[model samples]
Target chain A: MKGLAELGEFGLIDHIRARFPQPVAPELGIGDDAALLSPSAGRQVVVSTDLLAEGVHFDPGFGPARLLGRKSLAVNLSDLASMGAIPRWFFLSLAIPAGFSLETIEGFLDGLAEQAAEHNCILAGGDTCGSKGGLTISVTIMGEQRPELILKRSGAQPGDDVWVSGSLGDSALGLKLLMEGVRLGGAHDPLLLRQLDPTPRCELGLKLAEAGLVNAMIDISDGLLADLGHICEQSVCGAEILLGQLPLSPALYTCSSKQPVFPWPLVISGGEDYELCFTAPRCNREAIQKISKTAGIPLTVVGKVTNSRQVQAILPDGTNFQPSASGYTHF
Target chain B: MKGLAELGEFGLIDHIRARFPQPVAPELGIGDDAALLSPSAGRQVVVSTDLLAEGVHFDPGFGPARLLGRKSLAVNLSDLASMGAIPRWFFLSLAIPAGFSLETIEGFLDGLAEQAAEHNCILAGGDTCGSKGGLTISVTIMGEQRPELILKRSGAQPGDDVWVSGSLGDSALGLKLLMEGVRLGGAHDPLLLRQLDPTPRCELGLKLAEAGLVNAMIDISDGLLADLGHICEQSVCGAEILLGQLPLSPALYTCSSKQPVFPWPLVISGGEDYELCFTAPRCNREAIQKISKTAGIPLTVVGKVTNSRQVQAILPDGTNFQPSASGYTHF
Candidate 1:
């Protein structure tokens, strides 16, 4: 395969266009000074951006370019899901080092196209350039939601019940296993897959917003505790989470049993889960349960908002617990 | 002042917020999962993204962080200007190496805030991350334009008169001077200022589109000939540019006389001018002249679109001259 240096800027862009043609064309795409997008009438636009550096966010040793590209878009989609918006368009800025292969770029585009097609998002516009260092991918996603249906972090009431979607800690444990060279005796471990390719809870988030059940919502990117803390800070409230109530996969439970360190910290503060953590009125429990069944994802009540401004954790045996550090720190 | 390491991610974000607060809050802004913006009725959104890397796009030796920050936003605004769109919001994703200072970041933010206020654009959302390599800034700008007034590259007719706003080659000469270690006896060289802080021809572009005088438009980021070539390709037409008619700043002419090489290629294909190159019907020339007079910017007619598909340059004596290279290649 030819290297990336051979493709140049316009060639790479044309390659991307050929590889990932949208089912419906935008008003303008890939060419011109800017892409033109007609947003849905009467809906508010939601935008989120994320920058992923090579060594800081991922390692070449960890996975192939395809999965890395998938995770990058998934992370941004998670932010849109948190806002209870429908994913629509995205802008990608890629800085790739020399000697990178064109095949690798195609693999990355393949992964991005997969996720975009699944979520009905269009690749609107972006920039690609040569990097003097390692690969850096910056993505900005634009989504839409009705103003009333839009979810923010400031609406959680004191009596709201805090709930989490799917399971947590699996991705964190997967990263730990990858770092320690403990591969669970084979490839394709479920935990490792969780770490490599997270599924954004986009559909479930839209359902909750459409049903008018969620008071406030955020994605569990920087772990359950830290992201929940963000909602609390914005809402001027506190939360008490039950340790035993956190939904953990059977794989996570089994792996933690074999390790010396209690995996509670990973479950609580470890990040990259991409799960939806939200709060709603306690009276909406039955409605949420119905959603859980229809959405095919487990929804667990892990905590409740309080009038105070302290976030506390409760152990399974009713003892108070506190984590030494909170969430992932990029710096 | 505390260093960036001491401030951490959220702390740095809060610092940015305090330093660059929005003129008017959108539906949502910083400190949220994603920003929310409401688009005006019947207007199409124009989106563009650009990535500028240290050493690739700019060096610390070239200018201070303030000018670098201002140029970064200016480049994106130029794209919006090319589309005849009113700039509205921007998202910045910054990757800074460890040990980076807070003072530099604050200076950068100050410059960005100044430009944002001038253009009426809001710093709506962004991502800040730690990089193991050189600093990279990726900016995504969003704008709006009435659908009918939107200027595109595909609208030029065979008889359209090709025009460019302001003088060319000033920015290209500035970079040459910087590299040759000729500081023009220190401080405030007009060429250096042009390269460091290019003013996007936003108001002129808007006037042309609003008056329906321009059929096609593009910013001269990749130089005049190359950018006009883009319009030819999109419009499926040819162009013939006259060398004598090309606008040259006195600074460029003086510098070129001092050097052995002719400045034609630099003026034709050297990048980063950030001026506007456009095409309009011959009948609209008088109207365009009127707008140029009111806008206080020189508008020069240098070329014409043709029925053939070749982009040719002609000398002052009227002989065709072909360039060895067309423009900047990012590879």
Candidate 2:
């Protein structure tokens, strides 16, 4: 807690384990050399990783460690949701800058525990060190799903319905307010909540997977249109979206309040919105509605997959529009 | 190779895989989210992680990426050897500073592949990213052995004979030559190779484990005295080692051109000597010799364990002493 070297390797691990949910994996957790988790039946494993750097992905001045931890774990889980897998274990390797306090690490772990418990997952193992400056958190998540039901970005077919769960763009709007020196101050804005703690569409993913309805899936981390493009590229298909029907938080308009910035910017290019963007065949449309009903998530028909290998956006007047940059790039 | 964003995630991974060995562990290898490796039967897994910061661990001015990769993998493998575990799987996560050349990344991966092939180990799964500044490499390794045969730093009993493989101080001396503008040309001086590419004692470890001769095991990562002191503190025992018996490469004296300058400083305080420091019960004295003979590694007896729980260096006259400053500390 005081100095990383002072705790030594095993002592430091014990210190960290005290703050996390003891990974329920049977064979080994932190004491031994490696962890062991049995594979689930009729399922193939799914994995994904994300690295979050201080000062880039987050600003310590306003982005507290808890929120950073929450967001870090959420992003990886969202990836698993894209594959319709059940996230069960995580390995976190954290590099803390010297300026960071033990309290900061604890706050991060606290958020990790809270979010992990929501989906019955646990922190299985990790490596920690003191960096020269600025913190870095790298997390790798392991999940599993039935082979037939495993959703992939490359599985979307022509004529499939493009769908998304719950709301979008709120997280982007929240960032705009933060940049504009708008203090949330406990304001009644779902946009602020979305930014601080965007929910992973785990329930909806499981519901759809169980019902065997979705064709292909991806988490909307890099905004809607850009991610949709990725799905189209992988699936060898194209898509067309009715942009006028883009979902947005009413609170976004209320907060932006006559700033002609066009809500489309937030609705389309907003990253960190961990909602599921998926494609479903027309035959499964009713089943998808039932998934939304069962999971209590709003499933909106956003677009349709097309035969042509190009993505086009249409206005209410059937006008096509083009945007220069597509999505987030972590270079 | 270039910017990770430019290569795209899958492209970068493909580039890496093209260079590394295809894993024989058919169950888990690259391309998956996480790898699943079967540990040796009846053996408990021994796990350890090490972080190599660009500035802290290597000086790019003199450090080759291939050597860095090999050394990074070797350090983790060294930890496994210290625990008498048969090194098996490695998970590497690297963060390279932006604009780092493709040649540099390729060179590093080449070095990693060379070591993996030599050690009979597999590269499982890992994450790669572009950092804001310096590169940071983190490796987690898993080794397995019979649960009861697995050695620990806390298992040495009083009167056990202390032993070490290979030599001490050579790698540190090699590093000094590399950094201090003393390059010996024409593939001479094995010391330089030891410094740049420290060979892990994984084979020696398996021999010791199979022979059931080791009582305690540790890799001499920090100076010999500092590392042995760890065993003393954890096992609640003491050691009295003859200072003059420390191993030194003839090349060191040949390179330095000095009358040893108190060999204790080089042997007791120098670091990066990836040799195995361990203890074996006095009854297995002959077994230790047989292990060394069969494994083709010299095993030099250095000291004996005691009930005192204090570590003392035996002067030529057999008087006891201790080093002034211990070992490496990152914090």
Best by TM-score: 1
Top model number, lDDT: 1
Q: Write model 2 residue lDDT over B220-249, tens digit each, in one string.
A: 877888888888887889998887677667
In terms of lDDT, the poorest run of 10 residues in model 2 chain B is B32-41
- Candidate 1: misplaced stretches above 4 Å? A23-26, A182-188, B23-26, B183-188
lDDT per residue for candidate 1 within B125-233, as digits (tens), equals 8999999989999999999999899999999999899999899989988988888775644643899989888998888888888998889999998888889989999
Model 1's alpha-carbon lDDT is 0.89
Give all TM-scores, in the order shown: 0.98, 0.84
Candidate 2 local Cα displacement, residue A326, angstroms: 2.3
* Per-residue lDDT over A166-244 for candidate 1, one digit per residue giving the tens place of the 0 to 100 score: 9999999899888887553365388987888899999999999999999999999888889999999999999999998
For all candidates in order, the CA lDDT equals 0.89, 0.74
